[model samples]
Every structure is written in structure tokens, then in C-alpha cells.
Target: MRVLGVDPGLTRCGVGVIESGRAREIACLGVGVVRTPSTDELADRLMAVAEGVEGWMDAHRPEVVAVERVFSQQNVRTVMGTAQVSGIVALAAARRDLPVAFHTPSAVKAAISGSGRADKRQVTTMITKILGLESPPKPADAADALALAVCHLWRAPMSDRIAEAEAKAAQLARNHRARLADAARERGSTGGQQR
Candidate 1:
């Protein structure tokens, strides 16, 4: 699938595109900060980010967009801003009818480096190695976006398996509950109540 990965930020949203499959082809496409002048209003900054993401969608026309899921942390302000930026990115993808998927930071790290706690350097190194690139993608955010794409690709199959397993488990639990209910009904009909 041709996927566009976005690391959203009001000041600098990182975007990357890659074609993932047996061949594992990657195209950095472009990566740069979308800056809104410091004097600009917050709404303007958000608009700039939205425009940047929309421009990317127009250029890439990707099959799907993968975005990093925002997590609440100690810095509420930063987390809130990131969440807003992420919404803008998601909205851009939805506007184009592109499927959007979110991957958590730990999932991205583990998919790229075999460990959820992997450091930034390790993530960049693994992304470069997996993509067989001569140099790491510039700026940590860009590398992170690429990593998020890779993570989604790696996780998709597993997600299907997990869903199937959960469905089976749920079915089994329902059957067991039905059996218990039937037994209770039988006991009640026989007037054999137990304390």
C-alpha cells in the first residue's frame, strides 16, 4: 500500500510517504517544518499545518494516511496542541477519502527497533536500515513519521489475527454463559434451588 505518515505539530508537522509490500519501497517525498510566524494567531498556525497536510495529500495521493496517536502526558499544553494538529492531519486525509490509521509511539518504536523503549537514535537507525537508505531521514520528526508508517504496516496483519482471536473468545464466552443459563433454568423447573 502507498501510505502517507504524518507526525503532527503546530510548528512543524513531519510528513513521509512510502510504498510498502514485498518490495518495501520508500520515498521520503519531502520533510520540512510548516512554520507560522510567532506573531501569527494560533488559529493561523493550525491553518498552516492543515494546509501543509492537504498539499501533501494532493501531491502524493496516497492510498492511506498513517498518523501518530497523541497521548496525554505531563505537559498538558503540548499534548493538547499535538492532539489538535493530529486532528487537522486526520481531517485532511478524510477530506480526500483516504483511509487513516493511528499508531501509538510505543508501537512505532517496537515495530522499528524491536523494543518499545528504543531511543530516537535507535529508531532513526532502524528506519534507515529497514528502508536501506544511505542516510537517515533528516530531523527526528521526519524519521518518526516514517517509523509510524512502518509500524502500521507491521501491525496490520497482527491486528487481523488479534481480532479473529477476540471474536473466537467472545463466542466461546457466550456459549459458556448460555450453558450456565440453561442449567439454571433446568434446576428451577425441577424445583431444586441451591443456596
Candidate 2:
């Protein structure tokens, strides 16, 4: 599967694209940061970021998008900016009818580096090894974006199974509810007629 991963930030949102192959082979197609001028107004910065992300989506044409889930930070302004960029990524994906997956930083780190608490260097090193890259992907944000994509690729099969199970359970519950309603209706009709 081809996936686009996003590490969202107002000033420097990271975008990366990768493709998965047989036997867990993964290839990085592209990785980079999308920057917006901090001096610009919030609305303009958002627009720039949106356009930058859209450009990546257009260029890569990924089947799905994986975004870093915004976690609580001491800096509310920073968190807000991250959340807004993340939303832009989701909206852009939705416009193309693509599936979007949000994975937390800990989850991405764990998936790539085998530890939820792995630091950026560990993640970058592991990502380099996983992708067989000569060197680590530049910029922690870019590496993080790649990690998000990798995490989604790794998790997607299980997610699909879980979704299927949930759907089946929901259908069974609906069917059971319908049967109970039908039985109640039959009882109501028969009892009213007898009365």
C-alpha cells in the first residue's frame, strides 16, 4: 500500500510517502518538510500549510494518510497549531476519499523502534535501518512523518480485522434486535385481537 505520513506543525509540517511490498518490504518514495512563515497571520499560515500538504498529496497520490495524533503539550499555542495542521491533512485526504489514520507519537515510536519511549535519534536510526537508507532521513519531523506512515502500514492489517469483527458484531446485534421487535409486534397483534 502507498501511504502518506504527516507530522503536523504550523511552521514546519513534515510530509513523507512510502510504499509497502511483500514480506514487509518498505520503500520511501519521498520525504520533506512543508514550511510556513511564522510572521504571517494565522489564517495565511494555515492556507500555506494547506497548500503545501495538498501539493504533497497531489504529487504522491497515496492510498491513505497517516497523521501524528496531537498530544497534550505545555504550550497551548503549539498544540493548537499542530492540531490545525493535522486537521488540514485529514481534510485534504477526505476530499480525495482516502483513509486517514492517526497514531500517537508513542505508538509510532514503539512500532518503529520497539519502544514507546524511544527518542528521536532511536526512531531515526531504526527508520534508516528499516528502509535500508544510507543515512537517516533529515530533520526529526521528516523522520517522524515516515514513522507515522510505517506505523500505519504495520497496523493496517490488524485494524482491518478489528473493523470487520466490529461490523459483524453490529450486524448480529441489529438482526437480534429486529427479531425481538418482530416477536413483540406479533404478540401485540395477537393480544389486541384476543382482547
Q: Per-model C-alpha lDDT, please?
A: 0.83, 0.94
The sequence of per-residue lDDT tens digits that candidate 2 reaches over residues 108-194 is: 999998999999999999989988888889899999999999999998998889999999999999999999999999999999999
Q: What tens digits encode model 1's per-residue C-alpha lDDT throughout 26-139?
A: 555555455556568889888888888888889878888999988897388778878999998888888888889999899899888999999999999998898777898878
TM-score to true structure, per model? 0.80, 0.85
The candidate 1 region of ten consecutive residues with least summed lDDT is: 26-35
Q: What are the RMSD figures for all models against the true structure?
A: 3.7, 3.5
Instruction: List candidate 2 stretches off by more than 4 Å.
Output: 165-195
lDDT of 2 at 187: 100
What's the alpha carbon RMSD for model 1? 3.7
